[model samples]
Target: MLQHWLLGSLALQNIGRRKARASLLIAAVAISSAIVFTGVVMMRSIETSMAVGFSRLGADLMVVPQNALTNITAALLTAEPTGEVLDADLLDQAHITGISRAAPQRVFRTEQSEFGGQGESVDLIGYDPGNDFTIQPWINERLGRPMQPGDVILGAARDVPLGSEIALFGKPFRVYAKLGRTGAGTHERGIFMPSAELLALVPAIREQTRKTPPMLEPRKVSGFLIELTPGATELQVRFALLSHLSGTKVVAGGSLLTGIRQGVTALLGGAISLVSMMFASTALMVSVLFSAIVTERRSELGLLKAIGAKRSQIVGMVLIEAIVATGGGGLCGVVFGMLLLRLFERSLVYYLTEIGVPFLWLDRMDTVLVAAACILGAGLIGAIGALTPAWRSSRHDPYDLIRGEG
Candidate 1:
């Protein structure tokens, strides 16, 4: 026990003596660990956000005009503008089996200048409040009251303040509530209101454009939001809709966000590959650094052996020094990584949005796990790096090393 204590003290003293070199090694490990931590946390966040957003959407399928399928999908997923209109009477003509509820929506694009510097055009969704199950729950949770004629609800990403009146088509509408971040689809950038109010605004819009009145005629809808009954599958409802509805395309909810999911998956793959490369490079650096340190301290190790120190003790001492350096650095890395993620979160989201990918930051539990994994991984790397150096030093001939020939 005394010998072990002496060996530990010697190792610590040696680390203190080479403080600058030790700090460099620690920094290298810390940087690598930080990259890994951030990548894992961000990827997990994206997945979780998608799951939550999809759950909240609460739709089993979407039915759109056959020619407007691509445009409608883009509008719903990426907030892109759509010009397609469908006959609202299609709801009466098509009755899908196992469908418990359906809501029709009229989609339009707000003028670019009306966004108050948002840079991107906002999608305006007009829904029948009485028939809507999709947005009603969110509205109830957020506003606690039914939507009035002039009320508008903004999506998660809108910077508009609650109760502020925003002008659209020469008329002002009050912002009733702002939706929570959904992180997956167009709800993050949409403005929802009752279809009657949206239809009423069409005249003003036409007057502003100097076109003939009634550009958006009454009873014209863009798409249908569908909900299935209990024990009914989306596939079953989809087939029924396709069989009953003519000139319309029915898409399952799971298939709606395929493009965005693919993009996120690609981004995650690239991030993982980059992090793996960083880990490999960091491990190689640690190995090279410790090997040099071992070569430089050959005489010291030899002196300890001559004084009856066991080979295992020498190996343990080297490993302890490496671990101590890396462990401290790993903790710092975790902190740095979290800070980096927070600082760049908005920018990251914007970039992903531009590329049409979904992005989300990790929640508390995920962040903690990422930090722990990074710190532990750093320690493991340090131990592995020290192995070769420790073994070489332990096997050295004490006589030759002492005479400066080892």
Candidate 2:
């Protein structure tokens, strides 16, 4: 009985026989639904890449020269550097906290490259291989050999390939290895070397370089990377360290990431809401078209009712026609949106890479989410468009509709 109501010959005839209405309804939905899905997928892809990059650092707190994170994060995430220097002593002081592991180093921003083809601006990080709190293992990779003072490791974002010779200031050093992708972050844009090697490359650097002149002295270690001891809460240690550091600050990854994500969420929510409003208006237009068509066929409906066809059955027939029209539109929109994303990715990489920002790959998960959203959005809009026609058809009086008389 249910199948007969939904799949009846009459319901099927209504859609195939009406070329103009079906085309209009489908076109309206396809454009609006595609815009909605595309916006959401792009926002999520970039934000998710940033979060993953932060987690990969494996450090609880980042210590940079005062106000350096924005610059540091940009340099690492986006490739732009900012911040003044702090005393290198802070690195030791952070380590003395008895509850943290602190890694300290100097970062020199310059057009330094390995196996030089064209010079690319890179953050050349100089550290004690023996005491790096983060990124040292990736640099000191054992697969080939341990990094010597003259060695360098290109980050995944580095344009140079592995085992290439990179020269800075006329001093050519071997590229020991490449670090794994930190997903569109700074490590990818940097060249890591021992502090001794960095000093040897520059003449103005070797003199008065007490414990080494940081890329900017008195600014010493730009900041310390802090890892709390096991079983200890990050917030608990953060407060203690801040109290001790006084002029210096300790910020947690959670605080930074949360702020950025919230800002993005608000922005995306605003955009989607606007698009939804537009979709609502378009759906109403579809409603009007279907409503008129049903009214024009009122005599046919009345005749069916008189012939013992239920009002409910007639209403279902109108709704099914609307659903079929919108569903096909939804599928086409999803496919078109995905193809557009792929076409634009190459162009996007140029701008992102130029600024030292990480690349966010639009993978299978993103595709699935986008497709589901398109399908669901069409179903909801189709249901709304069908409502008026379904109600009007069901309410007609057979005598008024058929006899051409009230």
1-406 per-residue lDDT for model 2 (tens digits): 8657544566667776877767766777777667766666776676565544433544566655455655324212221245456677765555545354566666777543333455556687766666564575344233366556667877877666567776675567787877776554567777777766765665633432223334545336566666555445667777777766766666565544434444554666678788778778867877787777777777887887787777777777777766767767777777776776766576775677678666666678766977887777786677678777777667777877686422
In order of appearance, the predictions have TM-scores of 0.52, 0.51
lDDT tens readout by residue for model 1, 1-406: 9877877788789889988998887888888888888778877787666644543555667777776635333223321235666678876776556776678887676554255654457677777877676564444234566567899988877887788889876588889988766564567678888888887777787776565222157867778777665556667777777888777777666544433544555676788888888888887888888888887888888888899878998898888887777877788888888788877676877787688554556868768887988898788788889888888778888876676555
lDDT of 1 at 128: 80
Model 2 gets an lDDT of 0.63
For model 1 the local lDDT of residue 21 reads: 91
Q: Which ten residues in a row have the lowest lDDT in candidate 1?
A: 72-81
Determine the backbone clash count of candidate 2.
14
